[model samples]
Target: MVEFDLVAPRSADEAFAALRAAAPDGAAVLAGGTDLLPDVDEGRQRPRVVVSLRHLPWRTLDWAGPSLTIGSTLPLRALEQDPDLVRRFPGLAEAIRDVGSVALRHRATLGGNVVRAAPTSDLVPVLLALDAEVEIVGPRGTRRLPVDRFVRASRRVDLGPEELVRAVWFPEARPSAYRWQRVRPANDISQVAVAAACSPADRRWRIAVGGVAPRPVRIPSAAEALGAGAPTAAAVARAARAAADAVAFPTDRRASADYRRHLVATLVERVVDAVVRAEGFPR
Candidate 1:
């Protein structure tokens, strides 16, 4: 392991200062360290300093009417266990459960996932489907960006040197579902994943997929194919087809490009159908 200084800031201001101070040499912000530590161990990252957010007061989950704000440091298990999360954002809840195992979920955090911006992240596709926004705090001030804009590419994000993710904001509750095809049933990465949601306010559908290169993304064509409200079986099939053709799937050790394309098509239909049925939409 590379030698690095570790600092746990008690306040947001101090955290910012610690980051700014360590900027010249390279610094890493640690939430739960589930991702960061592994990267460090593998020599993927060698920061001069590791700023820990453990002492910060950011482990929060709040609901205001239809909106939800999740503190960046909050554990994935906390989200999975939230009584209303499964009902209001079923897709998000399902993604949380899919992260790893119960033990890993206890330490894995939403902010870390977003910050790492892994191409195969199970949460990102659902966040895209939900139109989630990332709340960032830095030396300048706090700012927010849509998750779509926040995540730029694989293992990359739009975070500034001194910035840290404060929370993720979901503007409204939606009827949604998440599904994935993995090599193993438990503690394995997904070969392909799909998240589908129907906005309650606009009655429009949204579809997002993972396991693509660069980043997870919303498939507008697929979503449009679903039309408004409950989609017919034919429409769902069309959407699935559209999704299957949407992204350029990469052939990796886990699966072939053709297999991923097939999985996306199949999972898209299942997720959309799940949202429609589970949410009691008129079929």
Candidate 2:
């Protein structure tokens, strides 16, 4: 790995200034560093300067009316163990539980995972299904965007060179479920993952999938079908088939395209069924 300067900023302003000073060679923002450090060690990223957000003031969780705002630097382990978060956003908690091991989760930040934009990121699909929004601070000031659009493609995001993720916001929570297909129960990386959220009262639901494409995507056809009415086994099967057909799976070391397609169908059905049961869908 190349030698680079590491700057630990005590505040957001200092972090922003450091990033500006390091341009256009650019600086990598270090929060948790679970993903960035590995790439840096592998010589895949050679930033001239590394800005650490660990000392910054972005590591708190708060409630904004009906929404929950999670500081970007808040550790995944905190989210996993927060009783309020677990009760309100069970699906998100479940996804975070699947991220690496307990030790890794202790050092991984939710923002870091979203910014990494990897197809296999455990939290991305669940966040998308929950309609989460990301708050970012840059040279221009603060801005917010839907989580689904924040990640543009594999290992790519909408954040500007000097932008730093401040926090993530989730609207009112609803009944939700998540299921992932992995090679083993101990493996954190998923071959296919599905997240579903439902509002049985309104017959509205959302579904998103990851690890089957360049980026996590909402399965609109399946969501539409499930949201139209009660999701019976037949209806769930139909939605799963639609989701399988809609995803563009690519062959990867963990699994083949065909295998991923099958997993997507199966997991979609499983997650939808789980959510339906949790929501007590009418018989």
Candidate 3:
């Protein structure tokens, strides 16, 4: 690993100042360091300075009115095991559970996962399906963006160089399901992943897909079809096919473009089926 200076700020103010004063050579924020550390060790990243956010105080999960607010530095394992959180957002819980392994989850933060902006991130699609929003703080101030829009592309996000992700807020809980396909059964990045959520109050279905595009994508067409009327197996299949066709998967070492497309359709079908059944809607 390249030699670098580490700055640990005890508070958000200190962290902000450190970010503003970051050297011209460049600086990278460190949350759990589950991803950043690996890149540094692999020589893929060699920032002159690393700002560690682990010392910041925002590491608790709470309910703010009707919405669920998750601290940016909270461990993924915390969310995966929280009974209340699991009951409120089963899809999100499942996604977090599938991220890496028990040991990794203990060190991985939701904010880091979102900010890393990996196309294969397990939580991105599920958060998009839930219409989650992220709170960002920078030299300017705080601003919010939908989870779907936060990630611009692979390893890219909307955050500025001096910005820090504060927390993620979910409007409310809804019936949802998440599924992913991987090359192996052990802890591995997903080749294709799909998440589906149904808002019975509005009779709307939301769908998001990952690992088949440059970034996670929401499938409005598929959501429309499955939510148009009473969901049926035939309708779900048609919608899944449409979604599969919509994504242009790039050929990667883990899977071919054609195989990724196939996985998209199959996973979408499974997610829709699971969501519909869980919502007590006939199919």
Candidate 4:
């Protein structure tokens, strides 16, 4: 392993200065270090410096009124059991639960997942379904981008070299639903995952699928199928199948593209049934 310096800044501005200094040299951001650390241990993320974002004032700077801002260091486990989140946005909680084992969740942060931009990331589908946005900061300033557009590639994001993720903002507490099913070994990528949700407050709905594509795929038509009116079991099943059919999934070791499509459809339908029913939808 090559030697590297670890820098911890007191604030975002300081962090950006450190990043700028390391830009010509090569430095990487460190949150909970769930994904990057693994690669580093396996000889992948070689950098001259590893900036410990731990020291920055993530709690204060991250909070934005109305829209909830989450720091990059906040644990996934924290999200899984968040009370306000469970009551206000359970769909995201469901997706967070499926991220990994309890231990991994304790160390994995939402910002890391968004910045990492893995196509099959568990949070992507749920966040996209909820229309979450990311706050990116660097030498310039902060800018917000839709989560869906932020994860446009399989393994790359839109962040520049000097950029460091500041926070993720949830503009509204949209009611939604999610389900992820996998037929793979432990710690392996998902075979098929489904997430769906609707904001009863505004009649906005979202249903996104993952595990079968480079990134989470959305089924707007399915969500549109659900107006303020909730559907029955049969209708839910049909919507699920229709959603699976809508996306052009890619094949992977976890499952065949054909099987994944079926999983996406069925799981989306099942989760929709669960969410709508859980929230007291009319039969």
Off by over 4 Å in 3: 23-25, 228-230, 279-283
Q: Weakest 10 consecutive residues, lDDT, candidate 3?
A: 274-283
Backbone collisions counted per model? 0, 0, 0, 4
Candidate lDDT scores, in order, read 0.92, 0.85, 0.86, 0.76
State in Å the error of residue 50, model 4. Answer: 1.1
lDDT string for model 3 (163-251, tens) is 89999999977778899888775589888889988865576889999886688899988888786535878888888888888878889
- The numbered model that scores best in lDDT is 1
Candidate 4 off by > 4 Å = 59-67, 184-188, 232-234, 280-283
- Cα-based RMSD of candidate 1: 1.1
Model 4, span 131-238: residue lDDT tens: 888888877778889888888777778888888878888886665677767664446567777777776556656888888556787788777766555775666766
Name the 10 consecutive residues with the lowest summed lDDT in model 4. Answer: 58-67
* Local accuracy of candidate 2 as per-residue lDDT tens digits, 1-283: 4688999988778888999999976688889989999899998888889999989788899987657899999999999999888776778988999988889889999999999888788889999888899999987899999998899988889998789999999886667788998888654689889999875446577899988668889988989877554576777888899899998888979899999888898898888777766634433
Candidate 2: stretches off by over 4 Å: 200-202, 279-283
> Can you list the residue pairs that collide in candidate 3?
none
Task: Write the residue-wise lDDT of candidate 1 on 1-283 in tens digits.
Answer: 5788999999999998999999865899899898899889899999999999999999999999999999999999999999898888888998999998999989999999999998989999999999999999998999999999999999989999989999999999898999999989778888999998899888899899998997999999999999999888999999999999988999999999999999999999899988997664434
